[model samples]
Target: MSGADQHIHIEWRGGTCRVKWWSGEYLDNGRKRYESKGGFTDEEVAFNHGRDKLYEIRHGTHVKNRDGATPMSDWLDDWLAAMDHGHLTERGYRSTVENHIRPYFKKQNASVADIDVLAYRAFKKHINAKMKKASSAANIMMVLGMVLDDAVPRLIKTSPVERTRRRGKFVKKPKERKKDMTPQAVEQLACNARTVFGQAGYVFIWTMAMTGMRPAELFGLTREYCYPNWPLSDPRPDDEETERYEEDVERYGRGDNLMPAIRVERQVQYADSTLQFFPPKYESCRSLVVPDFLAELLKDLLASHDHKWVFPALKGGSLGAVNFDYKYWRDVADGADERSGPRTRGARPAIPPVPSFKGRRLYLLRHGHKAWLDEDGHSKFATESRMGHEVPGVEGVYSSVTVPMERAIMKTLQERWDRLRGGSSGSDA
Candidate 1:
């Protein structure tokens, strides 16, 4: 071997051929780095292996030994630490790693390079077997894919996880639209909530149904964020928000002409066994307009409570996310009976189950609010903005919620409430 052939060296050792090839990488000491393989009976086989390795190096698809040696757990830790995520998102990622990823890979003692297509498929099988919910399994797989993707070109040449689009007849069926609570059903739920949690609960149910604010946003609502106070109580706007703030100030100063609104800037998050205030998911901070009826309801509720939070726990202070459903919400939505433990003397009557809300999560109220907005034929920009969702593309950039849209929303919502109330009164007659 001579000239260009010198880049690859083949020698016979104990009647078997060994091959070494320059990796095209240089050491700090001005020396050429080389990689090798052994135990080939034929010299041509060893030479071909060396040629393929050299090709990979030149194409930048080679995974160095030192980089590939990193353990999956260690790599996951580094990947998670480098991610820019909100507190809740970070917590969720950590949970997925600790609860699913670590346990499965721990037995294999897998390294960064050990996970190939077969290994990833095996892991997916294991995840499916362990997780009851398909959604949970999918989420874990997504996190694992992301972690591996971040390691590309460094720890591994490419991620083993492959995402294929469902094509033709294999495409997923459109999801069934979620059921929305009717105005009368919402009223029934609120009355039930009032029985279970007093006036605060009554107002809480109504607020969620009317505004579509997320459960966390409602949980974290402070006195200053509620009607008649927000926007005014908020700190002075930064430079970019100056114009909007001026417009809001002008509108607010218009006495009875003002359409009530709440600012959704923060949410209550539970972490490390303590409740903390964090920005709403995706930091979708926006002002939500409310009907006059809801404004009066909020005013009365605010006057009733001296706590910092607009809606405080029965025992006082911020509401706890843990066991909240088991303790209070289940009774409110599912209803309580003799089996719900002995009723204390002077306790409110057993809550009758709202049929529509049965077996449903509290978050559905927000969904129902969106449904109501759609039913009333509100503008897409106004409805999406109200729901804390950004409309995509050029439309979102150019369109915005104007005063007329806000006023229209408020009027429709107020009318819905009044109609429900009038029906209830007529039934009493």
Candidate 2:
């Protein structure tokens, strides 16, 4: 071989044959680029490999040397920096990348080009083995896939991750659904909370179970958003809110049919030791109808506090994320053991556990509320709307919550409370 045919070269190394192929490209300094690989035992095999490299280079399928050398950790940092996410979302992404992605790739010393199908599968196995929940492992894998896909055609030819559809009878098991709490169980929890953290705790548990509001939403609730007198004290409507106000007034004008409600506008998020208010998840800003009893309960609770938050922390101010779970909720749900203090002056009573709520999360109240709404045979549109979830398709656009729908919800919820308290269904307890 000579002249242009000499662009592909096969030569003997110490103990093996090596191949070098011209890439048919030029550098910024006007020099020809060459790609090479070695360690082939057979001369013919090395020659064939050189020819294949030449073909790939000419077809523009070759990965650039600089891109292939970029480290996985550095690439992930760049991708995360370019993302436009809310404070809370960005914090979560950063946590996942730092805690899982960075460490694994750093240990393997992986580069952008190192994540092929086998490497991706191995990483998935590592994540599954380390993570306690299948859902958490899936989320980590999704983030890795996103990072790899973003490097396409530049750092990588294609992403190694592909979503596979599970088939046949022996498919991957679904996550276990959270258990729903019965009305009696919910009341027991509320009662226990009252004993442990006072009246505020009692009201907090009831509000979550009845309203189906997210924990963040409750943490962010303020006097302006909650209304025991509802439409009577509702703020002046803006141009966009005019039609809603008119409809509300028409439907709830009579004193006998007056309904109380609360507005869901924002939620509290804790990050970097600071509390920030952000729009509700998916921006599902809505008005939620409340039962008369709950309305009165909220009124009394608000009257007792001058703090900005409706459900202030036991020590006052917004509830801290860690403190709420460790100091307050654990004692309330799991029960506290009798203990003696250092000076024997701080001795406290042992609070008995709520059997039904033991080992459960506070978020389960929201789930149980959905189950209750379903049990009561409420319309999908109303129930979903109340839960701050968007209804999809034409049904969402066409169907809306009418006065009768809200009234029925209010009546049933009140009845449920009354029944649980051993009072007549329609009695004012």
Candidate 3:
């Protein structure tokens, strides 16, 4: 990734001294170093400077950043902080350890080039000690490689890890998730809903099963973006185009009779305790086609709620902490049997305590919807768009494009759901 940096720049403020500028690597934050050759008066000078610095930084032969070298733990700590700024979700932070990063190299003091091959090779053996799934191990390897790869330009540290780490068939890929709502779990949770926090949480879970959007996308949803009724739906509301949304929604499904299929354009996030607006996760925004049942649900969800959001309110509109802490939600799900909805009519059975973690992420709905589509033989373009895989370069190219359709994709998914419900493909629910 390097061979792109050069050490030279100019100051734009004072053209006479404009030639005086920043270049090369600077040791940063006690032991870590960052690629430093940018602030230049001329664009070419800055580009050339950073470009060469990346080469030296990644290759690990650079003179400027020798002091930044440290144990793997220190570098990873810095990496975690840096990733906090970039990730749209906490997956980056949580999976790093749970997926087997700490077990092997947590103690090693890694230089740029050395950490790539040998340490990782040892990690592979270490991972096999605990991880039974090949795909899971592969995922850990991928995260390690990506972190090292990022060091290429800024740290100019040589990473033995390559972008692609396909090492034989031992590294099996993870099975794609197809089950959005298992019948037992859904029934148990629905039964528990009425007795606790009312119909709201159940409806939220139902919304996930019915519509294949993510939790953030659901939370960011507003009445203006969703409702087609008078007042709230009125465009150009109070002038100044307070409508940061609906530009594209109107562009596609415009006017009074607009059938707004939820399109994720932006999200409200609480970072540094500040409410910030940014584009949706997976980078590219998409529009999903909801079933007619889900459409009715959305209409009710919009009309019934006084809250600004479709889901229940939490002060700042971010659910980062609430996601992991499912005790409150678990209590609701576990106690739902005694509650009354349409069918229960009260005097329901006593339900058991269930793990709330699985129910927490609304994105599980995406997997369920994709499975149904795959069974129904939907197009690949439709599937990819729904998943929102718009990242660039390697992952983007692989993800955005639809691979050849598999024959078993439908049969397997449908059969699994059927088995869960104690029914066959031809049997009625």
Candidate 4:
């Protein structure tokens, strides 16, 4: 074919062919672009490859050429440095790179292009061999995907994670099943916490159960954000509570039964023995309504403490989960069992002496809160907001939290509080 009619030109070397083609368009600056691909056994195959490359560039599907020869470790370091640190905690970033990414990639000296789906499969197998959690494995895979995706055309042509179909259905691994706690168990645990760790633990456990706040968010709470009688932000900051309450009534059309609310905007995390405060997970900044009883308790608790932290450590600093769990939660959880009684002198407590669920975690209280909200028929939007989770899909976009919904949540929490106190039912506010 003539050069004008032929989109691709091919030339044969000893055993291979080289193909060249115009990208078929002028760039925005009126510059012509061409492409070349080689190493095909036949001229036709080389031509087809060149033609496909031209089409990709023309269609804006081409990955721009960048440095692809960097080692996986070096690439990861650069990528991590360039990442939006706000999106994840420093610990999370370090954990993924150290515990997951490097361990899998460092063993191989191969470039990014040499890593394929089989490499990923082997990495997953290695993680599984170590008995890692399914969720942890999944997260590692996700991080790898992110790296490979960003490495396109520069480091690798396409992602090597296989997305194959079986019988017209997409293949997917089953997620790990997290245990959920019941509201009754939550109440019992909270009471046990009170007895074991004093009033601080009691209020902390109850707040988690009632508000569905993440442990980090709960720890991040400050008195200024806890509006026991009004919204976190009064439209008129200079105005009195009565004036702001009246404004809320007019704006939100709320009635007399308004409960307390907490603003969730920050979280505290410990990385490398350093305590740092950051934005809430997924940046899910929102307000949560609390029961009147909880509000009163929180007010009293805040009044008693002179520190900025709502739940300060015993020695007056940030409370770390590791210390909290070992010192207080383990003992309280053990004491919840009827089988666990007074310890004998000079004897170690019976290992697993409690017949009851001895391994109750603080997070289970958050799960219990969500369950209670579901049981009380709170709107999905309100529940997700309270739980610090973004509602998925169109419903999330359309639905919003309303005063009535908040009122209903407060009413249910109040009812649960009464029931916990051995009352038959709760009276309407």
Candidate 5:
């Protein structure tokens, strides 16, 4: 071997060895090699030691024939695409790729292999930066582990991610965000929405704060589903007008719906052209819910309009964050939607500021609901149910739904939201 980069030549001389240095990682025999930290005692020892080192450095560890070698970038792409027909949820597959996985790895080469602790640390720093949040960065690690694990029998001899996932000194979730949204702050937002967005928009914001439902739930809500005149189990609506429409809803969605029994159940996401409902996070399936007032408000939001879908969704109520699609509504934090209104002579209460706009993710609303429910003395289990947390058990088995106080809970919630929205004192409401 000659020249000067990081290369070594190993000559077998019985027990003694000869080694020569050159550039690059390949050996004289067309195989890959590595360098040793210390020189060998004999010429033969030097050749054998250097050869082993070269293999270790290139393929990582003392392994032979590093087959299926590809860059991390290529592997991730294959992993994400592979999720298409797999059991993973659309939200899990798509978003795990987008928000956490892809952003950090989009540029990595597909042919590279053998990552060490040092490389991982540096890579983490770079990825942590691109990630929008610390939890998001953590999620990236998780998704990467899953993707690599799926490749266990395929490309990888063993997952580099297994070590990466358990690496030293984990970064804690940032405490600065203060994921709490107070009642007063909620009211302020509502006031701002009413002043800027008028009735429709303000109501939309209020519904999210009160319900704990994702934005899509509000948007995809249809008039027919919540206000159906059928019995709770009966799918059909009433034949006659019945005693009253509002009373029937109040008894169900507003009444029994708040029973403190909840589950994440299912999720709706847009795919191809239409909306599809699937198991929620962890493939959880069931009805996630909150106090009855939310049930009532949701029901009311549906009842007041003739639209079939909950929010202003097109193409049969596409799922996920609907606001993310509408640039006009999206400009709420930026006040970009500011235009001369008939009532006011100025732009609408436009985007407040960059910091303010950044504060309004779907999780923010969920956090706010958490503070509200906790203040109201709701149990942690109930709250978890509202969030669609899955109960642990043996998988590849039957699944069930369970919620104890589903109706009476609604009674309390309805009372609370009326006061919150109507500007009345709701100590118990």
Candidate 6:
């Protein structure tokens, strides 16, 4: 018999026949390959199953079956460790794998080949049972899909979790547009944050609301890159802090007509309880122009503190995400923790709501900034550039943000500030 025919065998286990076979294909590293599949009532079906494994080897769509027998829990762990992830993203991925993916698959012993559309459907069902929000389930699925897609042809033939409508219905919920915080709500959140987190909190929230900066980008801002005065040069250290800032000076310089701007180049993240910094997401390094009102406020902040970070924690360290959320943001957004003490009365003054803000994230302020730009009627190109998103198609080629464009944006923002804050202009800061 040929080598492939010699390797095929049949065995009865648990009142059913199992097909055992050699794939006749060595791994790239020259390791032997084998496969096992059961649940056939007759030897003929078992033989056909063994032949199917040989057929797959003739086609290059699959590799040796070493990883095929490995449990999904172990495979997912290996997959997560093998892929490149930034500190923050790695944290999130690990959480999903540990908290959600592993538990659901704990009883599953089926290898990569055994995992199929039915398995994914069951996983989705588990997710739906556990999660109340469709968005949360969707997020978990996204990460799972990424893992499976990367495992193609090596650990599995193809990703079992397909996005297509298999049975005349879409599997996932239709994408929903996130609601934006209103102008009034944005103003209130900033003011309340100031009261709760002090001046640093005010500057942090206001800057994000006006600038549309990612939270990491906000945490990443430094004194050197903060340009409070429009079209005017700020004092630069003798040594360049970042090469990107130096390149910006060489390429764009301080044009006489340019508006006040902040340099957004890096982002702060946490890994293993330690702080890490890297280029902003997608390397979306850009200068964000500040309105005149915000410029003055930033200048005041810059003058008040000569630290390395523009928005450091009250203590002498970079802000932590957990610390920022629970200590400051949650209290302000959801109202001061319901004041519980032995001497306290039954009820306290009702905490006023900030429209769509209760139980929502501080990032909503950033999303609201985009809505503001859209309402102001800025060109899509300018809006996308300012938001650090790449504008698509030919419009991106022909469209460049001009002096007039900058002025219009600044004027619109200034008008909003004046109208909302009742012409107070925030006390020269």
Judged by lDDT, which candidate is best? Answer: 1
The residue ranges of model 5 lying beyond 4 angstroms of the native Cα positions read 1-78, 81-173, 179-203, 228-266, 273-275, 283-285, 288-300, 313-322, 325-338, 341-359, 391-404, 418-429
RMSD of 2: 4.9
- Deviation from truth (RMSD, Å), model 6: 6.1
Kindly list the per-residue Cα lDDT of model 2 for residues 192-304, writing each as its tens digit.
Answer: 78766667888889899889999888888877778654455556546888887776665544366677778788898876678888888888788788888888888899888
Q: Give the TM-score of candidate 2.
A: 0.80
Stretches of candidate 6 off by over 4 Å are 1-51, 62-65, 85-87, 106-110, 162-187, 229-258, 334-359, 420-429
Q: For candidate 3, which ten residues in a row score worst on lDDT?
A: 401-410
Candidate 1 per-residue lDDT, tens place, 231-319, comes to 67867547898897878767653377777888888999888788888989888998888888888999899989788888787766666
Residue 235 lDDT (model 3):
45
Which lDDT tens digits does candidate 3 get at residues 1-429? 223322333444544222322233345554433434334566666655555555554565554444345555556666776765444445555466544565456555455444656666777677767678877777677777766766664454466674555666786656644334454555455445434434555555555544466666665766555533322354443365456344435432544444335555666666665656566875656544443344555678667767666655433333433552363355544343344578743455555654532434435445655566665665565555666654446554564322222223324433444565574333111
- Encode model 6's per-residue lDDT on 1-429: one tens digit a residue: 666677789999889988888766577888866678889999988897787778777776655656666778778878887968766677788899889988777667656667789998888898988999988999899888887887787788878987954777567857545565555766677677766645777778789989999988888777767865322353443365567446556433555655678877789887667777787887787788788888878878878776677877766366654467877678667766445467854434334456467777878777889999999999888899999998778998888887678778889988888887774433211
Cα-based RMSD of the predictions, in order? Answer: 3.0, 4.9, 13.4, 6.7, 10.2, 6.1
TM-score of 3: 0.52
lDDT of 4 at 153: 64
Steric clashes per prediction: 0, 0, 26, 0, 31, 1
> Whose TM-score is higher: candidate 4's or candidate 5's?
4
Candidate 3: where are CA atoms >4 Å away?
1-86, 89-158, 162-196, 229-257, 268-270, 273-278, 288-296, 313-321, 328-363, 374-379, 387-429
Per-prediction TM-score: 0.91, 0.80, 0.52, 0.71, 0.55, 0.74
lDDT for model 6: 0.75
lDDT of 4 by residue, 11-129 (tens): 78888888877766567899765556668897667866776766676665664333445678888887788887663555576678887788667777756766788887887788767
The best-first sequence of candidates by lDDT reads 1, 2, 6, 4, 3, 5
lDDT per residue (tens digit) for residues 257-370 in model 5? 323222233456666655665545454333434455444445555566555544543333333445443532344433344467678555554444333334455457667776
